[model samples]
Target: MATTTNSTVVANTSAPTQYPFLGLPYDIFHELCLYLAPKELLVLYRTNKTLYNLLKSADGKTGVDGKHLWKRVWQNSPDSAFPPCPPWMTEPQFVALCYDDYCQRCLRPNLLGAGQIWTARVRYCPECIKTQFTPRNPLEDFPKGPYLNEFINEPHLCVPITPLRVALGDRELVRDHFHTPDVARLCRAIIDASAGAGGATDLNEKRSSVMQQWRSQMTQCHEHAKLCHIWQKQRARRIRKQRLLAKRYRRENILSRVNALGYKQDVSCLGHRYQALQGPILAVFDKIDALTDDVIAPQVIAFFDERRTLREWYWHRLIIGVRLGYLTKALDEYRQAAPDELLPHPVDIATDPMLRPLFTLPMSANVPYPIFQGLLPEWIQTWRKRRDDLLLSMLTDDAPSLWSCMDSKSHKSHSSRSVTRSSASHPEGPAAIFQHFYCTSCENLISSAAATTHTCCYTFVENWRAEAWHAPKTDGKFPTTTSDILDSACAREFQGITGWSSSCLRPCAAVISDILITLGLNTKFNWSDVGKIEGMHLRCASCCADKTLLVMGWRRAVVHAFQEHQGVHLCWVSVPPAVSYKAQLVEHARHKLTKEETAKRTSWKCHHCRLPRAMDAYTKSRMDIHMRFTHCIFHPQQGRDYYAAPEGVQFLHPTILIAATELRSENLDAVFPEGEMFRNEKRVGFLSRVYVTNMS
Candidate 1:
């Protein structure tokens, strides 16, 4: 059985194969080719070498049979007006020149409509056109030889010229230009044809014949090119109209289906604008596929659902922002009215038990200011007591002696104390001292009232959480969990903001005790009382050098001791009030003023530094030491190097004037004087100006 199967396979493989189409008679094939369009005929011709050889004419010229067949095909074409092939060219070559979508020089495919230069009988891309064509002037470019006169008499007949309309001022001027390779070929033909000629008469005859034939060919090509251009434009318009009709049909079908699905209002809400919906509904405008319920229904539902969700999220945020704004205003008013009362930090207040739910509520829910304002008093009392207890505990742990003294004094009877007795002579509890609390995070002394709103510990973490909550995730989706659960998870991630931490409270009490001992004052002495003592001005001996004078209040003195001289003792010394006052004035001079203050004071001028155009005006806050660094004038005297100008003098420095104007306009890019500490102040200023311009 295996031997019989092998024999059968061998016999089948050895048999000759047959194609039904190729087997047709030549007369039937030629008849069928007549019905095919020019483009389709070209496609059939390229199917294989057999078809290519069969379709081409003998002698590679326009044979009578082949020309008849091509002429019949063109006559029956949709564009029957297509011009006939010129006598010098074969029908196939002309067809390929008009129908092929490729550059003739580089052979790159897909040249489309703009690529073919029908008059030139060539298809070239923009890049190839640049290299192959040249703008010419017959008078300048004609060669200096015996044939120059003939060339000058009629240059258009010698070589084909493409007329280009160039805009010059108010009119259009037509210029003659020719293909570079074609011009070279024509000149070489003239030279070679004359080289072998017996006399000038014969050469002239040959040249005349060639030129006359080209002139006729150019005329025919120009007419043919015009027809091709019109046909291409008409075809483009027809295709565009068809596409538009298809798009409209698809869009209407999709909308009707969506409405049948009970989404009429949703579709109407999306509106007719292209970018209104910004969802799958936009696909209807461009998509060409047939509308089906299975394909478009789910897309319509999902798009509207997502849009509704985004709208709700936006409304919720707006409500939260507005309510928070109201709460902020109320808090500011309360703080100004009673500056001494301790209140919770703004961030802490935002996340309070009573107000947190407001952030997570639906858009329809009302969150009036009274809702937030009503809870402020309770929050203040609770937070104040909590902070007081924590500070007291820290004091008791760090300094038992000081705590006992303050405790005893508080418990003592007030009736027994005389009215004339000074309160500074007796010790008081930690609560009595104003601005005595310290923050280890900022390494600064703060008041008990200020401590309530001190944000050193929670500022960074709270800012991060706010940004994370407001922004979407990497994949552009909001959190899927419940708002309350998400809020709690975020809070837990940052360990929660529950007032001041132990690190701040404990270090605060210890630093205060250490500062009291260094100042030779009782640990229980109130900071307010210590500030009033005569000649109590203190400077850090460790930070102040020979010429450098550093003077500050007792609060800063305590901070300086804790931060700079943490483990070491005896870091500060008392200075005379007069010297301290001078040092304070100098220190104030070194500091930069706010833009508001700079705009208010304009009498300042710099005498030592001369700017161009007399633009020498400066603000009083700025001119005090502008000469010291700006112009390298050392030891600038108040009256010589810089001083307040007379009432009539106006500061006109461009930078200063612009800064003042922007400040008045509430623009934040007001330029200020460059500090001596930064080396690249000019670069910094340029970057700031660029940033402000971009933002605006």
Candidate 2:
């Protein structure tokens, strides 16, 4: 009987020992735990009491190495993308708050974005803040109204009918929800302690100091919450703006394609007919059209229209209901489907049971599908590849012309180097008129003569001019200088230039008057009194949008304009500015060539041939030889007719001719004069030599 009992006991002990994981050495077990993610660890903790106890800290507060583990997990997660935990918050507290979305007070889900109040370390919904948070009277609460104001301003303090702990000199008193005898004891303790310290005089100062510190802490909490709210609002606004811009671009692209396709037969054609599709349905059409290579075929459009997908009410809700990602994925599925099989149409895809966010009436199974689904995707891919190749070819083929422009021996390039030394030596003479001008950003002085030749630093004045020429005469006679513009009597006679839009033509008189007080110009010259004076036409260093009409007279006027008069003092244009239209064209060409060259260096390909061939040799000389033999055969065609011949031959992109024309015009000297030696210039002298006789 004793031997049978011993065998049964041994079997039971052996059964418990079957778990190998639990029997692992302590070091090995810890190493294994380290590999598991926070979520996996949480799962393991819930699975068994052994794992829970192993993870628990000796202090009985947090899991072992909880801070480091939770922090590492959060850092690697997408949730840590923005709004990082404030430095004042602990890792555990932040993780807890992030996961705890429900209101603690009511235990119901917070419908609004109810946030946590970190100061008191609690969460509350908006409803609970007003209903559950019982406001304590200030006079009765903290011996005065200090605690009341703190509580009122604190956005986080939502707990109502809660116990309060107050410091009363050396004694600590806890006041209950019902305001029991503890409150009275707190008041007596404070009074007694204050009297013992040094009488009422010292007591008032000590109380005031403690109240001040508490107020400061509460103020910090309020500011933190306010800043966070503002950041969230701004982020949301930026996302909304980007989406709107993308939608507008898509709509404009569709309209452009519709016009290009020549579908408009007459007044009642596609162009006029599409005008009826306004509002949300118009947006859907835009998105659909943008996805395809061109305007969808008339047959495909008819197929969609028959099913009421083109109808206003149906498409409107579908567009608003479906996400962009789901629509793209559905389109991809259609593209990959068998050519013989009839794939579900885009409208049907949108309303799929699994994909649908909102319940809707089922689309008819007999709905006509687009015949071109399999063919259209392949065509679209081909068209895109051809378009990109053409763009790249245009950049590559025009490399020599672009380089020639940069290497030109024009007077603009030589003028700066030639005149720099002369200007410095004769600072007070005629040569001094070309004195060096320094950039505020780069701090490099570009001589007036060199300004035309200089490569744009992008930080200096965007539109650099050789010299500030006199403002052009509008009606054959008008005062030309800043001094003339600001004159009280002369200002009245100044009307804007004719034939130009008001946006382009500045009312110079009004602008100067507004800026004159802030100018702090020369102590010697009475600029307002000077008549029929000549001033240089200079550009602003930071001005963008040519519509602003930024023509200024010396450095001082430019400085004043930058400081005052709706001045953001920023050059925000995407394209860098140049000295002249010619310079800008040259720079644009150079930039395009550089971009293409960089791409070619990575993967050399011969795009000139009928079948685009990647060169095996990958030599510049080989590329040149291939281009001369192959691409030179094609004749240049005007406009975008070049885009039509996708495979047969290459046509030059229109931008090439546009750039050449600008450079040619500058060379002719008829467009922009090479020097300031015009009939007006023979009379106009240096700034120091200004006189009435010189104006004639």
- Candidate achieving the largest lDDT: 1
Task: Please give the lDDT score at residue 375 for candidate 1.
Answer: 73
In candidate 2, what are the lDDT values of residues 1-696, reduced to their tens digit? 121222322223323332356665433444455566544555665677665553443322222343434443443432223344556675445545544568877887876654565444457676655443333542344454333445444312322134445578998777533222323443454455455546555666655555554456556655565655554466457656777777667766654655465422211222323444545555565452245566454643443343232233333323333332343354556545644332332332332333333223233322122423334455345434543443334323323222121111222222222111221121222222213333343223333332322223211222122112112122111122232111211112111111101121111221222122112222134534323122222233343222222333333342343234332222211111222232233334445654565434412334332111211223344445555566673333322112221111010111111112223332434322322211122322211111110100
What TM-score does model 2 achieve against the real structure? 0.24
The segments of candidate 2 whose C-alpha lies over 4 angstroms from its true place after superposition are: 1-64, 80-91, 111-114, 118-120, 132-140, 145-213, 216-696
Error of 1 at 578 (Å): 13
In terms of lDDT, model 1 sits at 0.52
Q: Pick the candidate with the highest TM-score.
A: 1
List residue ranges in candidate 1 displaced over 4 A: 1-36, 47-91, 103-114, 124-181, 192-348, 362-446, 451-513, 524-534, 537-556, 562-696
State the number of backbone clashes in model 1: 2
User: What is the Å distance of residue 381 in model 1 from its true position?
Assistant: 5.7
Compose the digit string of candidate 1's lDDT tens values, residues 1-696.
121222322223433333355775444465577788876787787798766765665422212245455656676655645666666567778778767777888887763554767666777876787676666644345334454565566666546566666679999987766776667776666556666736766777666565566567777777777887887677667768888888888877877776787766555545344245444456645777666554665666787676556545544554655665676577777877887554455445556565467555766877787866777777667656666776555545444333222222221322222123232232343554422555566444555544444455443334435433533322233333334442443343333433234456323444444344434555445556565543344555556545333555455555555565662343445445554444344334434442344465545666553211012456654654566557776666777666664322111110101111123233343432331121212332211121101100
Residue 192 C-alpha lDDT in model 2: 54
Model 1 RMSD, rounded to 1 decimal: 17.3
